[model samples]
Target: MQIVFYARVSTDEQTAAHQAKQAKAAGFEIDVVVADEGVSGVSTALADRPQGRRLFDMLRRDDVLVVRWVDRLGRNYADVTETIREFMRRGVIVKTVINGMVFDGATTDPMLMAVRDALILFMAATAQAQTEATKEAQKAGIEHAKGREDAYLGRKPSYTRKQFDSVVDAFNRGEAVAAIHKATGISRGTIYRIRDNRGQAEAALARWAA
Candidate 1:
């Protein structure tokens, strides 16, 4: 059975690689990697994305699909839940890098199944909530920038220009937030803020003149 690692953006491609590496380190072998760049999981359904569609079509019974997190699958709770169930129904095993969570159609026990279903719902819901929170924070940052332009410029980023650019490039290449943070010593929030808000990040970088 083929093992596939999927991601959303080019930067997340790195995340996909990281996941593959982690899987390998854990004794799993990967056969393929797919990613869809510049797509928002919050808005797009899995079947609608180009690579996402390919992923669905490519997977076969007994194939394994690896993701950095449920959020990479989709941001909406229903979509995430439905996608996992569909995969499970197809005999495909869906696994996450974080927490090494596994979801499959292997159990017939009603209690066990119910517990698994509950976990799926919780994780998917948490993914959706995190997406909403990120968007809200992005909006808040922009709004705050509008009112306090000087303050925005004055605030120093935690990373130097060289450091930030390298991190940003890593992100643009599809690295996971956690992986990038681990390698560069940058905070996860800063990484997301830089990746999601390039204009603002660059403004801050210009102010630093690093």
Candidate 2:
């Protein structure tokens, strides 16, 4: 049975590498690492993503598929739930690194199955809600910057516009905050500050001619 580590990101090879290392640390020997870059878990269905399609093709009965979290599989509640159930139906074991959660189709007890299914629903719904909240926050941040454009310029930037944009792109592509910081040499706080308040930071950066 092949053990696969799947990641959804902007195709940063490092992300897959990181996941592989994580799985190893958890004592699972990975046979392959798959990733689809520039894909949004909120909008893209699993089968439609490039590497996602490959994952479907590759997984077989008894194969183990590992992800960082349920959110990586999808942010839509229905889609996430259905995808996981389908994989389990096919005898593919779904495992998460976050809590070492396991979803196996081998259980025949109806009550236990219902409990597992309910947990899947809860996690998927929470993931979707978090995605929506993030979108709302971004919108609010942009709107907040429209009237007071100069307010954000008061502070000295720890990173330049080029550096900030690079970090933002990686972050948007679903790269981990720590990975982005390490790769770009940007502090974690600055990367998040620029990401959460992109409009204000961008406007201020432009005004300063950065």
lDDT of 2 by residue, 31-72 (tens): 889887678888898988988999889999999999877878
Candidate 2: give the clashing pairs.
11-37
- Cα RMSD, model 2: 5.0
TM-score of 2: 0.73
Q: In model 1, state the lDDT of residue 9.
A: 53
Residue 93 local lDDT, model 2:
95
Candidate with maximal TM-score: 2
Best by the lDDT measure? 2
